[model samples]
Each structure stands twice: as C-alpha cells, then as structure tokens.
Target chain A: MPQTHDDVAETTPARADVVEMVGLHGFVQLAAFARLATDAEHAPDLRAQVTISRMAAGELAALDQLETVARRVGADLYEAMASYSTVLADFDRRTPPGDWWERVVRTYVAYGVLADLQRVLSRAVAPDGRPMLDDVIADSGYEDFVVAMLGPVVAADQQLSARLALWGRRVVGEALGIAQRLLAEHPLLWSFADRQDGARSEGDDAAWLRKQLSGGHARRMGRLGLTA
Target chain B: MPQTHDDVAETTPARADVVEMVGLHGFVQLAAFARLATDAEHAPDLRAQVTISRMAAGELAALDQLETVARRVGADLYEAMASYSTVLADFDRRTPPGDWWERVVRTYVAYGVLADLQRVLSRAVAPDGRPMLDDVIADSGYEDFVVAMLGPVVAADQQLSARLALWGRRVVGEALGIAQRLLAEHPLLWSFADRQDGARSEGDDAAWLRKQLSGGHARRMGRLGLTA
Candidate 1:
C-alpha cells in the first residue's frame, strides 16, 4: 500500500490484465480521434474545420505513444484493443449523438470520465507503464484547444449556448451509466484500482470514483459557462 | 506565357482567379484527407487501421501548407471554397463508394487526376504561389505510403486484386468525366493551363493531360501487380 498518495509508492506487479487495460485505453483514444475527424466534416467554417482536423491528428499522435507502450510490454496492439471494441461501440450506439453539437458534447464529457478511470487504473500498473499512462492522460494539451475553440463559439450564440449546456448534462448522465456498466465488465481493471486504494473498502472506492467523474464534469461545464 | 516548358518563364500576373484556383485545390486536399480518415474506420486490421489514420494525418499536414498559400494571397479561404462545394459534393453524391475498397480506389485514382490538374494550374500561379502549389502537389510523401500499404494487400487476394483493378478503371472514368466538367465550369483555370502549353492547342493539351492521368494509374496498377 502507498504510504502517501502517489502511484509510484506501490510496486504493483503488472500482469496480463495490464495489457488489456492499456489496449482498451488505446481504443478509447482511437474512437476519440476518429470522432474529431468525422465532426470536422460538419464544422461551419474552414478555419474551424481545419483546426479540428489538426487537433485530431494530435490525438492520433498520442495513440502512437500508447502503441509504443503496448510494444514495450510485448503485447500485440491489435489483440489488446479488439475485445473492448464492442462494449465501447455499444455505449455509443445506445446513446447516439443527434447532431454535431451533441456529438462534441458527448466526447468532451465522456472523455473526462474515461480519463479519470484511466488515471485510477494507472496506479495499478507497474511503474514502467505508469509514466506512459500519465503522459496519455495528461491529454490536457488538446482539451485546452477544444475548450478554447468551443468557449468563444458557445459564448457568441445564446441559443447555441443553452442547447449545448443541456446536451452536456445529458451526456454526463449517459457517461455515468456507461462507466458503471464498464466497471462490471472490466472486473480485473476495477480490481487493480480497488487494490491500489487499500485504505478504502470497495464500495467506498467505487463511490469516490463516481464522485470524481461527476465532479470533474461539473467543473468542466462550469468552465464552459454551463451547468452539468 | 512561358517561352520554354517551365511555369516560371513569364511572370503571368496572378489575379483574383488565383485565389479561387488555390481554394479549389485546398478543398480537394481536404476532401482527399477526409476520405482517408473515413476509410480508416473500415480498414481490415489494426496495423492497417492505425497506418491509414496516420497517413490521413499526413494528408492533413499537407493541407496546412495549402492554407498558408491561401493566407498569402489574401484569399478568404472559406468563401473561396464555398462556391465550388456543391459541384464537388455532387460528383461525390453521384458516385458514392460501394465499400471500403471502392472508397480507397476512388481517393487513389481521383486524387491522381486531381493532382495532375493542379500541377497544370501550378504552372499558372504567380511565381510566388507556384512553390506552395508545387510543395502541396509533391504530396508524393503519403502517396507512396498508400501504394506500399495497398500493394501487398491487393496482391494477397486474387478476387480483391481483380475487383480493385476494375474499380480503379471505373474511378478513372468518373474522374475523367468530372475533370472535363470542372474545366468547362472554371474557364479561367483552364485558360492558364492552356496558355502554359504554348506549343499545343487546347484540345491537344486536354488530351495530353488525360494521358498523364491514365498513364499514371496504369503504372501504379502495374506496381501493385494488378491490371489498370
């Protein structure tokens, strides 16, 4: 157990499950980037469209690093990601975005939750994997670009601002539901995080995670001048 | 007009049409890149998928330089591209891809012809704009990647090989038809290309361009061990 709240405090011996966890994270990245690229097609202006596309390229560049991590661990990158494709895709199919605005909101909100989950999983990884996971999650790089781009656009139109706020709230609801379901499916990943939080019981840790997820969204929405 | 076979022999003073021509080329690059990113979604395997996505990123990178060219000429990039959007989209809507293979083939063949057309227009740009156009056309950087990635895959399956070759033929036909229509609609662009070829009549120049396009495809198909 960690004497202090630091991922490096515990030398958790990573096993096969770490490979699957990383693979799922890699796939999540692929989905996020692909969505950005697709949404660029519908952007209202050329600058907006091209900027979004370039941001997507940045996201894909990060995916390349995740792949590098998989290779270092001797995991077949494709096999690592293949299993989680359905559950992730199903989450999307179940709560399909109605339009470009809804889609963007979903990605923004859900990625925040997903990144939090990945962070929880990070402490459970062997120290070698932690740095890679840390770099990937610190995806604060593009999150800033997205927020900057969206903030002014959303501020410019009162009706659009209101609609996005509502859409964002709905997205958080769907994301919360999906996260709960994901924990049930990925028990090994959950167990890793659970073990890392030895100070708290399983229920306590789960509740804390849910709080982090929602709390993160509320803060992000607030930043965008919207309520979660 | 050039006294020799070079684009820079005479300073053909570029005017408003230069902006529109560059804008159309930018839009074409955008379409080509967007198509790559989309086709990546249906790639047969993970390596193929990730590689295609990265290649799309490369194509997008090339677009950034085109935008730079747009800015240099004081072209409102969005408005410059807007008028031609309908015609471009119409060509796409009329000949939508049946599957991933068809879509890839369309981008490959159509892009070759489009690149050839742009090179002709590149000769017409003011010497300052010509270098940007040249760099963007030399987008041979990723074109080689597509051929390398695709060649082995096509060669592996006899049926796929035959289908792709036939599909390539169909794409060239559609592309040639589109190219002819595009010339009729944008007389200013064609006139520049016409004047650049001082020795050839307009009909002869058009015939030579078509030969270059098809000839390019035939050789590419040969490299892939498929009949163009």
Candidate 2:
C-alpha cells in the first residue's frame, strides 16, 4: 500500500516523525515482552519464559536500530514520542492482562495488529525510513512463542478457550479504539490511511483501518484457538 | 573475590543452578529495561532513555547465551529460575523507583554489584559456565549511559544530587539485604560467600558482601557525581 509520489522523498521531516512513532511502538513491544518475561505465575515454564523474553529483547534491539534511523533523518524523537504516549498508555490501561494465557494472547494480538499498521506505514513513509521499518516489521518473531504456549492450552481447556476467545475480542476492541483515537488525534497519521485509499476522507480511512486491523486480528485469533 | 578451590570444578549440578540464576537476573534486567523504555514522563529525554534501554536489552541477549551454557551443564533453567524469583522480585519491589532518576540509578547500581558477584560466581562454577558468565559480566555497559545522564543532572542541581545520592544508597541497602536473604534461604548461594571467606559465619559473609557491594557502589556513585 505504498504511495509512489515523488514528493514523498522530500518529506523527510514528517517521515522522521513517523519513524519515531515506530520507535514508540517498539517501546510498547518491549513492555509486552518484559511482562511476559517476568510473569512468573502464568509462565511457570522457565524455558518458555526465557524463549519469549529473548524474542521480546530482539524486538527492542530492532527498535534501537529504528531509533538510529529516526536520528539520521532529524526526527525529534522525544517530541514525537510524547505526542502518542497518552493514547498508548490509555490503551494499555484498558486492556490489562487477566492471567498468563491472557497475557500471551494479548501480546500475540497486539503485535500482530501493530505489525499490520507498521507494514502500511513502512511503505507510505520516505524510502530511507522504509528499510528500518521493514526490519522492525520482520522482527515479529513472537508467533512461534505464542503458538507453542497457547496451542496446547487451548486444546486441553474448552472453558479456558471460550474465556480467551472473548478476551481476544476485547483486546481487538480496545486496540481498534486506541487506533481510532490515534488517527483522530494525529491527523498526520491519517496520511497513511489516505495514501492507501488514494485521497480518502477521515471517515473512510478509519473504516479502512478498522477493516485492515480487524481482518488481521481475526486471522491471529483463529490461529490461537480464540474467536476474534 | 574468587577462591582457587580445585573442588569448584566438580559441582556441576550446583554450578548449573548458578547458571540459571544468571538467566533469572537477565529477566530482572529485562523487566527494568522495559520499565525505563516505557516510562514516558520520567524518561522525558529520549536520548538517555533509549541509551539505557539498549543497555538493558543487551543484558537479555547475554542471558540468552548464558542459558545455552546452563543447558550444556545440565541445569534446569526453569527450576533454577523459580527458586530465585522470590529473592530478585523482593529486591525490585522494595527498591521501587520513585521517579525517572531513581530508575536509572537503581539499574546502574544493582547491575554493578551483580556483575561483581557474577565475576566471583562464574569462577566458582564449572568452567563450562565460566565463559558465559564472563560475557554476561562484560555486558555491563550502562556505565556510560549513567554517567552521561546523572553526571549532568547532579552537576546542575545540588538538591537533586543529594536526593539521588541518598536514593543510590537505599538501592544498595535493599540490594544487599536481598543478597543476604538469598544467602540465608538458599544455603547453596552461601557457597559463593563461603568460598570467598573460607567457611566464615553468616555474619561475616554478610559483612564481606556489604564491603564488596558498597565499594563498587561508591565508585559508581562518584563517577555519576552522586555522593558515595
């Protein structure tokens, strides 16, 4: 969903802001990874916990590289990050994990949705930022971690599966709510929505984003034995 | 603080447990890094925040390597992790960061002391785990980040400096308290203290640990422009 507007190359300042937003998302990934790494009760299996933590740590390293990309393009990393912190923090507050299983599901679903957005943003942004964004997107190695942990849990516990299915939906709801809030507040981000839809209105952009995010969320939930 | 006891080579199971402890500490590092990476308000300065987070992330990578070493020595990573979780969590809870500055100081000081302990433990454990421990200890790169952030803050603000100096002392106090408790609860951890002190009493081991940790803490504090 990339726009090949030649002027896109000239928009480094704005694109840098977008790169910082990606970095901010990197922090979110780091936070989720940290939660998984330290959730002792839910993650009783040390091997699994370590495995997940390493994956999360790998994401942070990728974010570190992305920050470097932002700096090279003259992005005000702190200012860009500050603008979106409240929306993300609120989203996290509304979607606190209930248990170990819920934590894994949340990590899986949230990253999946964010990766979809990143995939679009990586393409819509300036080319310099594109490669870094691509690397950051490719760092979505949590799929194996999620399947290994949740596949068996869902198979064994039908009641737990039902609960998690509902939980997964709530996560999607909260995430979309946050995504909508982000788009509404940061009209700049709407550029991604617009470029993807070829000069669409904000309303259409929101609808498109919802469809895009929800479709990905449904596929991810199905994989995890949860109803979207 | 290493002893040259030849018997140190024969304790593979015990050594394996120690390696797992290293992995658990890696999670502690991961958790702390995640908190800093996500602490939007306190970490207002993006450069310092990202710098410290990168350091913490690096520690997790080192721990991943250490886990491989543990496996090589037949250590049960999860069991070892479970046993030490309480001690590390208690240390973290009691020394909770009051603000962003406290967060940085806490990470710097705890890791410094742990590196020292790991230096001793790495040698005391089997040779298989020694090289990994050496790498883990060598990964203590927060020194520059701490100096860069705290040095200026302390140089500019005397009141803040005094507050953080005292805070640094409290972090050390809480950390040593946890170390002593671990030594008491897990008699095996006492082996490190014992190897250093030639069968000294618990009181003496505690004193030695205090001395060791305090000396390193003072050096770190001085470097950061905080009072020892």
Candidate 3:
C-alpha cells in the first residue's frame, strides 16, 4: 500500500482513483449478492438454499465494509457504486442462466473470476483500498463451497456435466468482457496494476495481469468435472 | 418458554408442533428476505436500495436464529421449513407488486401482519418458542423505516397515495388470509395462543387474538398517508 499521496501518485493509483476502485468493488459485491440471493430462493433443496443464502449474506457484509471505507475517503457510496451499474447489468442481461444448473455454474464461475479481478485491483490501489478488497477476495473460499455442493452432482451425471461445461465457458467469456470494459474505463486503476506487477502489458491486458486470476476459476471448473 | 416435555404437553403445544411453528417462522423470514432483497435490487435510489438491502439482511439473521431454535429442538430445518413454503409462495404469487412503491408497501404491510401472527402463535407454544418469535417480532420496527421513507412521497401525490392505498389493502388482505390458513393448519399451535391469552373466542379466530396485531399495520398505513 502506498503511504503518501505524492508517492502513490507517482507509482500506484491516486486517491480519487482508489475511491472509484472501492466503489466498483462495491458494485461487484452487490451484484453477486443480488444474483445469488435469487438462486438461493429457487433452490428446492433446503440445504443448498440456506447455504447459498448465507453465502449471499457474506457478500453483502463485504459490500458494507467497502461502503464504510468509501465514506471515510470522502466518496459518496451511491455515486461511486451507480457509476458502473450498467456495465454489470449488461453482462447480466447477455448471460442470463437457462436453468438451475446453469444458474449454479454461472454464480460459481462468475464470482471466482470477478473476485480474482477485485484482488488484482487491490494490489494496485492505495492503503484503504486493500482492506476493502481483502474482505471480498478470500482466495478460493467461495470456490470451495460451490464445488463441494455441485461437484458431486456434476460427477454423477455425464449429460449435466457436458452441458454445464459449455455454459461455464460462456459465463467466463462474458465475465472477462465486463472485466476488460471496467479496466478500460478506469485506466488509472489499470496503471496501479502495471506499477505493482512491474509488467508492461497494455491497459486492456491489465485485467488479465496474472494468469493466476483465471487459473482459479478454470481449476474450480475442472474440479466440478466441467471445462473452464 | 416451556422447559419440560410433559409440562409443555399438558397445556402448550407439543415439542413436534412447536418445532413446526419454528420452521414455519423460518419460512416467513426467508420469504420476506427473498422478496425484500429483490425490492432492494430494483430500488433505483441508492439510499433506499442499501437501506432495504440492510433490512433484507436483518430478515435473514432473524431466520438464522429461528433455524438454531428449530435444530435445538430436533426439528429437521428443511422439513419444517418446506412444510409451509407453498403457503407463502402462493401468497407471493397472488399479490405480485405492480411497481416499486407497491413493492415497498407490500413488504411493509405483509411483514407487519405476518410477524404479529407469529407473535400470537409464540404466546401459546412451548417455552423455548417465545424467543424465536420475539426475534422476528420487534413490534412495528420495520414500519418506522417504511413510513419515514414513503410517507412524504405519499402525502405529496394524491394519485400515488390512492393507488398505493389500494395496493396496501390488497397486500394486507392476502397476508391475513395466509396467516389465517397457517393458524388453521396448525390448530395445536393456535391452542397455545388461547391458553396464553385466556381468550376463548374460537380456534378459527385464534390468529386475531388481539386487535393490536392488525392495529399496527392499519396505524402504520395511516402514518404513511395511505388508508390501511
């Protein structure tokens, strides 16, 4: 984390850019919670329903902490959050899940890639930004839960796994598209990635800085007996 | 709350029925959260959006506590909760909201009436039951939020108030029907209400043990500049 405005200004993201990154992180969390909460509602198995609902609650708590950080840094949470609502909404409309299994794979795959993206942005942000990201990006935490719940089913049914492998590919493609658009719109946050990683990758590639970001989702999908 | 099985058996609801009541309560909390979380999603005003999302989170927390009580009493939470899912789902299907204001009023009116019904059932159940009910029934707490948020808007627009007034009545009407059906189905739990309140009007009217139950909503509606 950068210590001073001048130092951060010279290398990492500036204060305003940090605030914007925090807000964008909040939007990601709010969007995930809203979508998973719906999945939880339609989940017929009470165990799955309750577990997903609890996961959704965890996402909201992460958003609340980020909002607190945003306010502390003189950012209007709503203003910061609403700034990128359409970016996520467009992704949602384009990748609407066709069935319960699709919904499960969608949440499982999309959350992984987005959380990983949030983590990378955290590395590039100012001091306060890291904690906000830290709360959301517990590496492989959500992945473990979704896999344990869905992997057994996917393993038992060859047909379901084959169908979901395709769905998983589609979800990641759109997720990456939104990830690129967000980084493109906020290039200052992109600079933080370059400064932190010491990579000379183009701004568009800022979102994919470490192959490790996409690796987590692909590995989780593989665990589920589906292609990434 | 009743301490011993025999003591609870003598006058209050049996352990099984008490467990059923707890599960039914869980369904109520879960359904409210599911509905309001969607309301939070559609709420365009960010302040209202976050506040409703927070309120939705509170409903889930209340559900979690009841689930704890249910499990402590050896109730399979899923079985207990699923028993009443259709009852609430049917209520939801019948009274779909027309717009955002209707959505807000629907939550406000429906939650008030149902929580009051849960409170009355608590009075008659075994000893451990009251606390579960108490957590969900904080006495017009949610109403305060709705009134403050919508009261002025209703006061300013005669057409919106009239429209919402109709919507509010419909929501309460359906809410009361489901509340009545639940009491009718679990007549043993209804007996707990009579025993605790010392009122012998009728088992069918068990849900209406006290006028104060419905009064909360009617009064809150008046405060919101709508006819209850």
Which candidate number would show the highest TM-score if scored against the true structure?
Answer: 3
Using lDDT, give the best candidate's number.
3
Residue pairs of candidate 2 with colliding backbone atoms: none
Deviation in angstroms for A212 in model 2?
1.6
Off by over 4 Å in 1: A1-14, A124-134, A138-163, A191-202, B1-14, B124-134, B138-160, B191-196, B199-202
DockQ for each of the predicted structures, in order?
0.56, 0.31, 0.64
Candidate 1 lands at a TM-score of: 0.82
TM-score-superior candidate, 2 or 3: 3
TM-score of each: 0.82, 0.80, 0.87
Per-residue lDDT, model 3, residue A84, is 80
Model 1: lDDT of residue A190 = 63
Rank all candidate structures by their TM-score, best first, as comma-separated numbers: 3, 1, 2
Give per-residue CA lDDT, model 1, range B1-228, as digits (tens): 112213342344335676667676777777766777888888877777777787777766556555555566666666676666665566677668888767777777787778777766665445565433555654635567667877888878999989888888877888887777676667666545633446356687667667766777787668767788
Candidate 3 wrong stretches, greater than 4 Å: A1-14, A124-134, A139-141, A194-207, A210-212, B1-14, B124-134, B138-141, B194-212
Q: Write the per-residue lDDT of candidate 1 for residues A88-202, one digit (tens) a residue.
A: 6666776677776677777778877777777766654455654435456546355676678778878788998898888887778778777777666676666456343363566
Candidate 3 lDDT by residue in tens digits, B97-165 = 888888888888888877777766665344555333454544425678888878989989999999998
Native contacts retained, all candidates in order? 0.59, 0.28, 0.55
